[model samples]
Target: MAAIKPKHQRLVLALIALAAILAAGALATWALRNQASYFYVPSEIVANPPDLDRAVRLGGMVEMGSIEMEADGVTIRFVVGDGTARVPVRFKGLAPSLFVEGSGVVAEGKLAKDGTFIADNLLARHDENYVPRELQDMTEHQKDAVISETVGAK
Candidate 1:
C-alpha cells in the first residue's frame, strides 16, 4: 500500500486536531449546561418563571413592609419588587448586613413549586455614594480631614 503524501497527511492531522478541539468544547458545554445561573428581575420572574429546580438569581429592591421573620429566628421572608411585580423570597440564615427594606438585593437560589424563591445566598447592593458606618455621621469637613489623615496628606 502506498503511504499518504505529505500534503494529505498534514490535512488529515489538522482535521483530526480540529475534531478533537470541537469535541472537548462540546463536552465542556454539556457538563456545565445545568451549572449556569440565570439572572432575572422581579417582573421577569413573575412573567416567565424558571423551572423549580433550576438555579437562578433574582434581583430587585426589597419591598417596604414585606419582610417577615419566622418564629425559628433563622428563616426570613421578604418581597422583592421592580415596581411592576413582586417575588416572595425565603432565605434561611443571616442576611448580609447591608440587606434591608427598600434596598437593592440579588438572591441566588432556586424557585419553589409554590412560587417562592428559596435563596441560598443573598447579595446586598449599595449605591455609589456608600459610606462606612463610622463616617456616615461625619460632616463634610470631618470626612475630608479623616480621609486626608488616613491618606497621609499634609
Candidate 2:
C-alpha cells in the first residue's frame, strides 16, 4: 500500500473531525427533540392544532370574564384570545399576581383531546413601558421627588 503524504493525512484527519462534529450535532438534536417546545398564538393554534401529545406554548391575552376557579379551588379555567381566535385553558396551581383578565400570558402545556390546553406553567407578559402603579399615578413633581429621595438615600 502507498503511504499517504503528510498533507493528505492532515486533510483526512480534518474531514474525520468535521464528520464527527456533524454526527454529534445530529444526535443531540434528535435527543432533545421532545424537549424543544414550540410557541403559538391563539389564532395559529386555532387554525392548526398541534399534536395532543407534544408540548407547546400558547400565548395570548386572557379573555375578560373567562377566568373561573374550579370547585377544587386550585384548578382554574380560562379562555385565551388573540381577537381572531380563542383557546380554552385549564391549569392547576397558584397563578402569578400579574395573571389577570385582559392581560397577556404564555401558557406551556399539551393540548387535550377536548381542545383544552393543559398548562403546566403560566408566564405573565407585561408591556415594555410597564411602570409601578405609584409611579404611573404620580404627578411629574411627585415622581421627581421620589427619584430624588431614592438617589439621596443611595
Candidate 3:
C-alpha cells in the first residue's frame, strides 16, 4: 500500500470539516426561513409590504382620536403613527391592558389586503413613563421612581 502524506491527510480533514459546517448552516437557514417574522415601520409597509399571508411585526405610536371601539368591544380598530407615516390596524382579540391611543406599541401579525394590520399580538407600556424614548431625558432619580412605581403597581 502506498503511504499517504500527513499534511495531505490534515488538509483533507479540514476540508471535510468545512463542508460539514456549511451543510449544517444551510439546513438551519432553510428550516427557519418560513418561521422568520420581519419587522416593518408604517412607512416601509405603506411603500412595500410583505406578502399578506406572511407574519410580520409593525411598531409605532397609536394615533390619537383614530381608535374606535366596535359595539362588540372585541373588535378594535386604530391607526398606528410614526410621525409622518400611519397604518390602520384591526384587532379582533383582546388587546394588551397597556395598549392605548398615542402609546408606543409593537403589533405582531399579518396585514390585510385593505391596508389594515390584522394584529394577533400587541406589546405596549402601561404608562408613558415606562416607554424608554419618552423617558430618555429624565433624571436617574426620576427613572428609578418610575421603575419602582411601575413594578410596585404590577
What local distance difference test score does each model get?
A: 0.81, 0.81, 0.77
**TM-score, per-candidate, Cα-based:** 0.61, 0.62, 0.58
Instruction: Report the alpha-carbon TM-score of model 2 versus the true structure.
Output: 0.62
Clashes of 3: 0
Judging by lDDT, tell me the better candidate of 2 and 3. Answer: 2
Off by over 4 Å in 2: 1-37, 131-154
Q: Report the C-alpha lDDT of model 2 over 94-130, residue by residue, as the tens digit.
A: 8999998866788999999988999999999764444
State candidate 3's TM-score: 0.58
For candidate 1, the C-alpha RMSD (Å) to the true structure equals 10.0
Query: Per-residue lDDT tens digits of candidate 1, residues 1-154?
Result: 1465877888999999999999999988976774443888887888899988888999877887899999999999999877778899999988999898856788999999899999999999754345676764666567444433432321
RMSD values for the candidates in order, in angstroms, are 10.0, 10.3, 9.1
Name the best candidate (by TM-score): 2
Clashing pairs in 3: none
Best model per lDDT: 2
lDDT of 1 at 154: 12
